[model samples]
Target: MRHLCLLVLLAASLAAADPIYVTAFRDPCRAIEVHRLVLANEPVVPLTVVVGGVERQVPAVSVALPRTDWVVHRALVDGLAPATEVTLRFPGTTERVRTLPADLARPLRIATGGDTMHKPEWLAATAKALSARDPDFVVLGGDLAYEDGKNGARVVTWIQTWVASARAPDGRLLPFVSCIGNHEVQGSYGGDITKAPYFYAMLPLGGSATHAIDIGDEVSVILLDSAHTTPIPGPQTAWLAEQLSKRAKRPSIIPIYHYPAWPTVKVSKGEKDPTGNRVSKLIREHWVPLFEAAGVRVVLENDQHTYKRTVPLKGGQPDPGGITYLGDGAWGVDVRRIFPGLTWLAKGAEVRHGYILDIHAGGRIAVTAVDETGKDFDSVDIPAR
Candidate 1:
């Protein structure tokens, strides 16, 4: 079956001289698409891609920032064959992307993390550690750049640093799928989508605050807004219910969003906005039942700078008939202490780490948390239900 994608607004082109970063993903309808964005000074440029020996010149959409020398040229390359190698050439440099196993019958490898901010140095280190895993693609849990999705210069520089540092041991650029977090928007919450210009420019979800992608009929990944730009129980929530209902029979369905439904850090006495309790309450009220009904295998969460795994839970209690929640993102961010002995928690640790998940077609998923030094400190395997 041909891959399906949400239509993207298109404009501009990229050049050979610009620094190129490649990312690949299974689209919303199970097709594999690859994208490359370059930060350059040139205007309206097209580049060439040699895929499995066939070469084609592709157009790019430019996202130009005001008062900056950097112009981001983005190209979405589709109709790709997995398990094969693809190469892109630009005057003095050439980059390569190794595709994942084409057949969904085999194991699929994915790396995930988030909350990368404040320290570009840690971002680099964590990027290297993740790269060593040689992931097919990455899923980030938001908070990409620190404090300013509105600042064009900071956004561009941060993206450049990320692109330059996040590379596999073989030097291939791993593709990433992510949602926006508090850091990606001004005021950190309740901002309109337009407030985060850089995020909208960098990653467009076909004009929606939330979206879902299916991986070869085996797994469905739902990415949510988490009140960053859209409120829960509104349009995004309704859309999520529809999505989950549609994908109910999929072997694995995983949801990723900014705030955790169960946070390991930060208690809320209802004093301020953006507190853990407030965010988690919103999710539990509007989304948890939908998840329970749909049989979502796992939920990936972030915004807390710690690592946590909840016992398979149903309605906030440990139940085998429920969902597993993983995370409290610590990727490149300073670790905060996690109070253990929480009722819903199975494990909790404050560390600088990211998770690698190896999923099989049969529905079993294995997750390993690796530190910045590339050591596996925690591991878990969830057998197929």
Candidate 2:
């Protein structure tokens, strides 16, 4: 009887020490038929990821942090039917993943926010609230983990918290799409890629800071670096123009970046730029024209820690047919005060919130702002462009 009890205790210990703590999905972009899963494990064990009936070996890579127990593994499950569900069997657990529809014939929900993880409890609350809404995927503009380009352990904990609290109502993990923020880098601005080690190590950004993802055939989500690891001008601008030109015909072209080109708060004390904020000047000069030409009706901007929505803007002026910039990223952070009498702002407030974008059939987008309690406070409807 004593030996049997000891064996049972041993089994319990092994169960508690399960290596896989973090599991996240990525790159549900143009590949409607494939899904990518990124897993972080504490032990370096051989993993065979089984999706549907097919099996694939996923090799683990060591995270480039000193004295850390975590390693990263990725698996790509392809040949999936759009809008179908599949079960992924990984070692000791299973996860349900769904693919996006090939066309926008049905409604899809995408939740987006930024400036996350200043406080773990706030992040937990906000993530749980967002999860209850059951978005198909999430796009975080940046400032995730607040690790300041270091502190790998903090990044790990943040991911664990997010995966735990942000699961779908059906217990499936939602795919994550992210862009680089100032907090992701060591120097905070205009630095080399090596400074932001933790961000690149965890995310599958194809080794560059800027990339675009197409949701079905109607919407294109363009994620930019916003001067974190990559600058805003020259090559990045050229690439932005090219990407916009290629997807110019798409009904919705949404750009998600860390800095707001139209800020609700001052960039610095005593700043007097007629453009509102001087920090985002380069983005205004370089990328705004491209956005106007491409007919990008909506843009997602973050990092100011206040809720904001600019009037439909053309050349910094309000126009009926122009782009509407939403956000100054107050997700899971202390809200900031909006500058008084900002002529460009249609609405500005001190609120901790995120956006739920309901993309319906026929290219219409219903944007709803939800607070940490899962309550809707603001909403706007954008017609098909």
Candidate 3:
């Protein structure tokens, strides 16, 4: 009788949980199938794809979620042309997912921003402005939720905000890729992966703390962990070197991390806490060289809560034959002052804004910083090398 009562309670609890489902950014991407899926309370849900008036059920592998009612599944659905519209159906809902450019000959618009600390007004306004641009995808720099992803219910609200804000003008959901920042963890640093339960549970980036995602043949985004969960100059550095070495021949190699390698507004250099200095040192000593050698034309960064652009430099000096660092994420937060007396610093802005990157063929790129009111405050153009 006791066992029966417990079973009934469990079933009732799961039944009461709200239904939530969202798509994740492709990690081990094939450029053909949507490999990431998040479905709550629906295990082994059917995914139907419609193409040319033909509907077929796709096979999916359900991943086990411990201690939660949410179910995650991955499906392999291919054979669709790029830019072609296709309808995907689940148990109770249907959505349209756009395919990549058929020939990879045109430009790719990407929205880049971060530091959304649970401010609903800023989030909604910025999201609304971002969707108007019709970006192909979004890359966030970190500090996703003000709750630090420690509270379960708060994390749920954050996820709901993220998903709701991801709708484009065409009504298609845009894919979001992010790097873990200090706010994602409870203590902000020196904690294991378990410290960020909601981050790991919600965004599955190939089960690795650091990973890279290639967006067609034009660009490869190498996402690094800036001492949040993993240390710099250690295992993640080795992996970054390997990934960059292999993709060196590609047209563009861009790196995006939570902490800016060259911060615009900090005088301490993290001497109080050794972790901060260590992260800065490791990035400067180990990773920057690799990026320079690999022809990384640009680097995206955040964590300073301001807008900044560095002069093109080679080996940390102002040189035309070097990479341009654009960053200091200003999403849902107030801006801070830029540190003075830095020769490498080209331009800096203290404003609440985000960036829109227009990547064109032959390695030509343009970045624009736009505030929450949909105003373009600054713009930079990096010509083809």
lDDT by residue (tens digit), candidate 2, 284-341: 9999999998988889999989998888899989997888899988888989888787
Model 1 / residue 256 / CA error / Å: 0.3
- How much is the lDDT of residue 344 in candidate 3? 80
Off by over 4 Å in 2: 1-60, 273-276
lDDT of 3 by residue, 183-222 (tens): 8877887666877766776565556557687777767777
Lowest summed lDDT across 10 adjacent residues in model 2 is found at: 30-39
Candidate 1, which segments miss by more than 4 Å at Cα?
A: 1-17, 24-40, 270-276
Query: How well does model 2 score by local distance difference test?
Result: 0.75
On TM-score, the candidate that comes out on top is 1
Off by over 4 Å in 3: 1-44, 59-81, 269-276
Kindly indicate the candidate among 1 and 3 with the higher lDDT: 1
- What overall lDDT goes with each candidate model? 0.75, 0.75, 0.71
- Per-candidate TM equals 0.89, 0.88, 0.84
Which pairs of residues collide in model 3? Answer: none
Clashing pairs in 1: 11-61, 12-60, 23-175
